[model samples]
Target: MAKLIMVVEDNDLNRKLFCDVLKAQGFEVKPIADGNEVLSAAREISPDLIIMDIQLPGISGVDLIEAAKKETSLKDIPVLAVTAFAAKGDEEKIREAGAAGYLSKPVSIIPFMNAVKELLPG
Candidate 1:
């Protein structure tokens, strides 16, 4: 089966671009705009990987990742925190929040896909 990647992003354009790229590469994409619903959705989907936008409405992506890490059912799925914020210490904060790695936006297709492959290599 194709790998399932759950994407939590608020921006419509950015979400579309991210999901489109993944779909084009033959991966199933679950694009979510609300960070609040991420945990519940993640539990249902049990995705192979999760990519999230750090800046979001309602609950922040980092907090949601922390919550995901706490949940036994979702804890093992690799989460990649994707943020446009390139400020100092952003990557460290992302990792500290329980993400396996980080991806900065606007993400290039090759590197983005490569990150996913590294996390869920076939």
Candidate 2:
């Protein structure tokens, strides 16, 4: 079966771009536009990987990923922290939040896909 990926991003264009890229590369993509909605969907879907945007409405992606890591069911799913706010020390903070990797925006397609491939290798 094709691997499933869950994307948590608020921006319309970013979400579409991520989905389009992953789908075109044959990965099944589930796009979540709200940080608040991610947990419930993640519990139901149990996606292989989660690409999360740090700045979000209601909850920060770092906090969400940290929460997910605390959960028994959700902890194993690797979260790749994707953010436009790649400020100093943010990468360390993101990693401390339990992200398996990091991708800065605007994401270069090749590196982004390469990271995904390495994370969820078939």
On lDDT, the leading prediction is 2
Largest TM-score belongs to which candidate? 2
Per-residue lDDT, model 2, residue 98, is 98
Model 1 sits at a Cα RMSD from the real structure of 1.0
- Across residues 78-118, which tens digit of lDDT does each residue of candidate 2 receive? 99999999999999999999999998998999999998988
TM-score of each: 0.96, 0.97
- lDDT values, one for every candidate: 0.90, 0.93
Tens digits of per-residue lDDT for model 1 on 15-83? 999899999999999999988889999999999999989999767888898999999999999998899
Which ranges of candidate 1 are over 4 A from the true structure? Answer: none
How far is 102's C-alpha from truth in model 2 (Å)?
0.3
Candidate 2 error regions (>4 Å):
none
